[model samples]
Target: MRNLLMKVNYDGTCYDGFQTQPKGNTIQDRLEQAILHLTGETTKITASGRTDAGVHAYGQPFNFTTSSQIPLERWCLALNARLPQDIVVTEAREVPLSFHSRRGAKRKTYRYTINGNRFPDPFQRRWQHHHPVQLDIPAMQQGLTHLIGTHDFTSFASRRSTKTSHVRTIFEAHMEIDRSMCRPSSTDQGVIYTYVTGSGFLQHMVRIIMGTLIHVGEGKLQADEVAEILAACDRAAAGPTAMSQGLALMSVEYEESWE
Candidate 1:
């Protein structure tokens, strides 16, 4: 059997989520069905992690062991042909049989986009969280700094998470204004982008952090209060969980190639 690693990008607006559910369509379901059609094998694929419903991905990596003799270079093309328009296999390569996408990942990066415009852009409605109220970018940036380093992220993690540990190390966290997508009519404002890279993330951790930061941006929470919230380790002590549409899995990283 050969283990293949593939990168996928998808628009999650129409699917339930990354993982398969009993009633709704998912990214994994579509990929498995495509593999079944192309390889004639009911192979199960493992991903680096799952993205919640309405959350998109720019670089989601997964691994599957198969007996098919398809050329490595052609795997992306084959899978793309069978997958839906919203999901595309961007790349594929051979990997060691021992490599598991989720277990082998060293870190992952996620990006959350916010539309700070007075009026929502029709094209960005599906991807960005539209917040009409002007945000204090400096305050949000300060709040993000507190998220760096290892700590109990219980304040930000979702109650639905089944993980035993709420402690995770955030390698980097910051936000920036994206002016390239700004409208001519809008002044002193641009799209806001929040980026976080971490060893691992609990369910809805990033979104919750975004929510807290948004609270800081709007003057509801002080920038320094983020540290207090982290120490509290109480979910209720944090701000609301931001909308899912704004979050996207940017990339998964490993120390070295498994090839």
Candidate 2:
């Protein structure tokens, strides 16, 4: 059997999440169904990580073992033809049998967009989180300083997570404004956009961080409080978890050693 790695992009608005679930449709379920239709193989595919409902992805990676002789380019086109419009296989290539998508990943980056304005735009409603309150960018940046580097992110994770370890290394975390892309009439004219990159993230980690920073932007929480939350190691100490729609899995990185 030959192993193939595929890069997939999907709008997470309609589906449940990335992982397959018994009660609802998922990105994995649809992709696997398409694969079965094309190759008649019931083999399961492995993804780099699981993204929650309403959380989109740009370059999510997955691998599956298949005996079919279809060429790499056909895999992308054929899968896109059978899959729903929201999900698409952007690229596909053969890989060594030992190249596991999840195990081989070096780092993953996630981006969260917030529409900080009084009114929401019709077009960006599905992809961006809308908040009416004006945020203080400088204060938000001050809070971000506390999130950079390594720390126990237990306080930022959801209470429902089954992860044994709460400690994760964050390579970078900061907020900035995307003025060029903001709509002319958007309340987000001077709104700030938050971008974060890290080796990996805990469940609800990015959202919680965003929520906490929002508090800072609103002047409800002191910028230094972020450090206190991390030191507390309590979920309740962090800010409320932000909406999942604003979060996107930007990309997953695999080390050269894996190649």
Candidate 3:
């Protein structure tokens, strides 16, 4: 059995999500079908994590076992040839049979984009969450500091998660504006990104965290209030769930230490 690991990047605008569904229009379904077409092999692909519907991915890793003799370098090209334009296999490599995409993951970094501008950009409407008012950046940054260490992120995850442990170590968390430009008549604001890296995240964790930070920015909650929210372990105490389109699985890390 030849084990292959792939780096996948997708727009995630039109599909249900990364996981396979009965309807067969997801990222996994498209990848599997493309692989089958390229190598005539049927195999299951496992991702580092599942992004919610309309959530994008930059360097999501997935693995599968195949007996096909395709060259590793050509796998990306071959798979992309059969897949939709929105989904692309960025890189492919041979890995040990012992490696599992999800199991081998040490940490994952997520990025959530917010359009903090007065006017919405039609071109970026599907890629970011548009907020029409100026946000209190300092308040949101103060809130992010509370999440940098280990804690039970119960308040941030979906209540539907039945996991035995809600505790995850957050290696880093921060929010910053990517870029800002002033024009003669208008401003060209790029976007604000909330970045979080952790050992693992429960379902909807990052999105909920973003929501809470947005609330902090809006002055609805203070920065220190995040600590209380985590301690409460009550999902209802958290802020609203942010839009899925603003969230992206930026990358999966397998290094021993992210610190």
Candidate 4:
């Protein structure tokens, strides 16, 4: 058997999530079904990690072993033809059999978007969280700076996570405001973009961090208290988990060159 790696992007609005579950209607289930149709082989595609329902992905990598003779270059087109309109196989390549998608990933980047408009924009509702109150961007940025180092992120992780260790290193964390998306009548807050690159994340970790930073923006929590929350190593110390629709898997990095 040969291994094939593929990079895919999906809207993720309708599916349950990335993994195949008993309930079905998931991104993995659809991809597996398409592959079974195209190659007549039942293969499991291992993604870098699973994103929650309603979370989109811009650059998700997965790999599967196949005995089929399909050319590597044609895999993307072939799979796209079989996949749903929302999920597209962006690229595919033949990889070493030893390569594993999830285990090989070195870092993952996630982006959380917020629509700061008082009235939610109809067009952006599916991909952004709507927040009517004006947020203090400077305070949020200050809070984000504290998250840029290796630390135990238990405060920001979901209690449902089964991972044994809560320690994770965050390489970069920042927020950007997209002024072009703001309405004239609304506060200059516009749209808020939170980007985080980390070694790995626990379930709902990014969302939880976003919620905490949002509290800082609202003056409910001080920027300096983020470090205290980290040291507390307690979930109750963190803010609520933000809505899932605003979160997206931005990209995955690997030490091994796929080229």
Candidate 5:
């Protein structure tokens, strides 16, 4: 058998999540069903990470072992034919059998978008979180600076998460306004986007970080107080966890073992 890695992009607005479930549609179920249809064999695929409901992904990676002789290009075409319209396999290639997508990943980048305007756009409502209040960008940036290093992110994670350790390294974290990316609406205010790239993220870590920064932006939390929250390691000290629809897993990086 040969192992193949596939890069998938999906709009998570319609599905439950990435993982397969017995009741609802999922990215994993659809991909596996498509593979079974094409190759006539049930293939168990593993993904780089699990995205929550309503969260999208651009370069999510997954690997499956298959004995079929179909070309790599056919994996996309054949799967796209059977898969739902919301999910698509963008690329596929042969990989080492031992190369597990999640275990081999070195880093991941996620972006959270906020519509910082008085009026929300109907078209972009499903993709962005609308925040009517004017945010103080400098204060938000100050809070982001404190998040640039390694720390125990217990305050930024969900209480239900089963992870043993909350300590994770954040290589970079920043927020920026993308004027050009904002959809035309009643208000011309630019949209604020938080881009976070880290070694790995705890459950709901990015959403909680966005919530804390939003509080800082609204002047509810002091920028300098972020360090205190990190030191406290109390989940209740952080702001509310933001919605999942505004978050997207942009990419996952791995070493060039195949190259």
Candidate 6:
């Protein structure tokens, strides 16, 4: 069997998430169904990682084993033809037999967009979180710094997550203002992004981080108080988990690539 690696992009507004679920439509289900329709093979596709429902992806990657003789160059075109409009296989290529998408990933970057206008932007309503207030940018930036290094991120994860270890390394964490602001005759300057690159993330980690940072901006939480939360390692110690729509999986990095 030939192993195929693919780069995928999806608008997560209409799906349940990346993994296959018995009840909800998902990215994996779509890809596997498409592959089965084309090759008559019930291929089990593996992804670099999972993204929660309503979370978008710009460069998500996955791999699947197939015995089809179809040229790798045409895989993307062929798959895109069968997949829904929200899900697209942007690139595909052959890879070594042992390459595992999730296990082999070195780092992943996530981006969360916040709309700071007094009114929500209709255009960005489905994608960006509407804050409707000036978030203290400097204070938010300071909060992010507290999470930049390696630490147990239990406090920033969902209470229901069952991971064995909560320790994760954050290589970089920062935020930037989006001056181009979303439409809405409001502040016309309420778009900002919080980006976090890490080896891996726990459930709701990024959203929780974003929310915690926002709390700092609102003066609800002191910037330095984040350190205490991290050390606490309790889910209740962190801020609210931000809405999933505002979060997007930006990119996944692997130690080596077939390309």
Q: Which lDDT value does model 2 have at 59?
A: 81
Q: How many residue pairs collide in each prediction?
A: 0, 0, 0, 0, 0, 1
Per-residue C-alpha lDDT of model 4 across residues 1-259, encoded as one tens digit per residue: 9998898999988989899888768999999999999999988899999999989999799999999999888888999999989999998888899999999999999999998876788887889999879898899999999989999999999999899999999999888888886667756478899999999999999999999998999999999999999889999998999999999999999998763
| Higher-scoring candidate on TM-score, 4 or 6 | 4
> Worst ten-residue run, lDDT, model 1?
180-189
Residues 1-259, candidate 3: write the lDDT tens digits: 8889889899999989989988757999999999889988887899988888999999899999999988788899888899999998888888888888898899899999998766777888888999866678888999889888889989998989999999999999887786653244555454898889899999999999989998998999999999899889999989999999999998898754211
Best by lDDT: 1
User: Which lDDT tens digits does candidate 5 get at residues 16-92?
Assistant: 99998789788898898999999999988999999888999997999989899998877888899998888989989
**Candidates sorted by lDDT, descending order?**
1, 4, 6, 5, 2, 3
Model 6, residue 200: C-alpha shift (Å): 0.3
RMSD value for candidate 2: 1.9
Q: What TM-score against the true fold does each predicted structure earn?
A: 0.97, 0.95, 0.94, 0.97, 0.94, 0.96
* Superposition error at 210 for model 2 (Å): 0.9
Q: How well does candidate 1 match the true structure in TM-score terms?
A: 0.97
Error of 1 at 194 (Å): 0.3
Q: Go through the candidates in order and give the C-alpha RMSD of each one to the true structure.
A: 1.4, 1.9, 2.2, 1.1, 2.0, 1.6
Question: Which residue segments of model 2 deviate by more than 4 Å?
Answer: 181-188, 257-259
Q: Score each candidate by Cα lDDT.
A: 0.92, 0.88, 0.87, 0.91, 0.89, 0.89
**Which whole-number lDDT from 0 to 100 does residue 178 have in model 6?**
71
| Pairs of residues clashing in candidate 5 | none
Between candidates 1 and 2, the one scoring higher on lDDT is 1
Model 2: weakest 10-residue lDDT segment is 182-191
